[model samples]
Target: MTSVGTQEKTRPCPRCGAGIGGDERFTVWCAACDWNVDPEGPRKEPRRLDRTRRALARRHGEKLHAGIVSGEDLRARRDASALLALVIALAVHGVTAAVAALGIWCLVHGWGGWPMLPGLFLLLLAWVLRPRPASLPDHVPVLHRAAAPTLFALVDEVAEVAGTRGVDAIVIDGAVNASVQAYGMRGRRMLVLGMPYWEILTPQQRVALLGHELGHYGNGDVRHHTVLGSAYASLITWWYCFAPEDDPAATALELISNLLLLVPYWLVTGVLLLLDRLTLRASQRAEYLADRTSAHVGSTEAAVGLTDRMLVTDSVEAVLAREANRAALAGPSGYRAAGDRADELWERLTSHMASIPEAEYERQRRVGALRGHSVDATHPPTHLRRAGLIAGERMPAAVVVEGDRADRIAAELAGARRLVGRRIILDGPSFGG
Candidate 1:
């Protein structure tokens, strides 16, 4: 067999096109690119598992490309999977409950000696298999309509055009991403907008983002995921309740029990993996449908631009974060100054993207394409989406907001931006206390 160092010499670094040198250690670093790799990292799935995932992704891609599976069909399949999961959960509980009941009957008939052990175990199993209710985040600040009427008005317009229910609440966050979530038993809608991400986009692009989020509701993606996610969580809870502990078996009985537990462990894990694989394709399709909805409600150009900017914004954030940290370390009063620096860096970086050549930009995007397809990814690769939009027929321009109306909405968001910035500084790496 080839030595590890020799093998590493043959492979190029993923980030920089330089040969990598490997030692026998589990961790490897590429000097040329400053890239680090850990063989035992969480991203390193087993080879057989990787192969199976690739095969599933390939099959799904083929079906999607061939038009063999419609978005409606994928939605139906997810719903069916949710139903099947529920049925399996109920069946397990029913069987366990019956076993527990039989043990109770035996005790009442004076047959209770060793029967008590099995009865208790059966009752525990039934309790473990019980379905759990979904959880909502606590302590999250919810923005009311009175505080940001202009923002809420924009969301209302987007929802009306997308044919989705109005957002029940809005949340301003510190991250560079935006999302919509369902909360409570009624599945009330919550629209979360990252102030950093919002500050980077124009009014038109903002509308596209809003449309994309609300489109999840219109496409039933939210409902499907809520049901499926809850079912998966219930299965995980059941698995954990009976999972074997990490201790060596010192006796034959202990070893036998451990071996038996492995059966259910593998069975439940397999089911979870299968459910993940099935729903992942649906999730990716939903992203595309949502993108289309965004293009419909806003302009196709705005949607495409928003997608491209997202790819660039990640890099921008990383560089600015380090600068902010450095600024904070310079002096006793540096923390407040760092926050302002972050805003300036964000604006500069975003503005600079427009000057880059289209050819160079496309080349940069292809780097993500090289990472290979994601089997369990929530969204398709950014490059793939951009390519699809470019090759497709042009859409009619549908400007949702413009002139003073857009300006008023953006002006209103200034207060929100300050709050988000303060939150970021307090929670950010630059803050010491």
Candidate 2:
């Protein structure tokens, strides 16, 4: 589902490429023109079970946090959590096997340690292979050789100023936008800034953007989203794999439990989607935290100043100009927007959307289909994102919008339903926590 009310980690506009922050969903418009923000949802309800069934929807990971995750503690926690999960998984497996063997084998014949042997090894392996916190490596790469130690050193430098640990990595994606893909137990798996994003903003503004992404990663927001999302995805796969094999007349109890395994992410996405404020909301909050981090690491003026400079559009335009370079490579009609087939597909999709109830879930599904994920994936449309920055531009309060701030952060988000390029929905809450 697309995000309506939710906040996103503020990135430069995917369309206009503006680097602004605020939460004004409906006010935002498509990057293509002055289209209204597409409302992305009528949230989807989880697939239902009989009245006798009992299962609560899974938690939508949307709670906002203040400040940031402390570096030392984060590292400790990552190691501990990974260790814990490994131990639990192995212990569960071992005890099951050992008890089964100890009972069944002894009853059937004499005692045997053969089966228990593997269990012992598993337990040992679990302890031995528990997750370890990854340290920033001392060596620098050729691409970063110019900066050398300074490259990663800068990460820590920024973090030190922010009162956090250094970031995970400094990726260089060809895209103009940047993202933080936190991994391990606690340490972040940052996509960091690409050269495009870097070139546009002044040094201070760049730091502000970095601080924002860091806020999300440090708060365990990234971990919560990814882990829960992975779990939910696993459940969906379980559902798809078993759907055909399960009895059509399955009992309600079985059905509910089975449904629990399959429907949580979509369901969670649906509810958060309907609420719609999580992305922009969470994102807004995260941006505020980053701002604080930047201010703490450096100065508040720099943080705010950085935000302003980052908003300048010329750089994003330059990055997108590269797309034109591939015009020759683009086939006749150069993509699917113009053809009769594309038109027919669009009509069919809109027709299908029209049939659904006016709710956040439905809107999100429609948006997801267009975005090319699942028919109900939990993401907002790209076009809507372009509009949000512009929406802030329109709001007088937007100029001094405060996020992660103790101050008012401009506008509160519009009611959760967001719209864009024929898709209106919310970005779903992070799947798991």
In terms of lDDT, the best-performing candidate is: 1
Q: Listing every candidate in turn, what is its Cα RMSD in Å to the true structure after a full C-alpha superposition?
A: 9.3, 16.3
TM-score of each: 0.67, 0.36
lDDT string, candidate 1, 145-212, tens digits: 88778878888888888888778788776667788876678777788887767767777888889988
Candidate lDDT scores, in order, read 0.62, 0.37
Tens digit of lDDT per residue, candidate 2, span 286-326?
A: 34344445554434554544444333222243323433332
Instruction: Give stretches of model 1 more than 4 Å off.
Output: 1-59, 66-140, 222-225, 236-264, 336-360, 373-376, 429-433
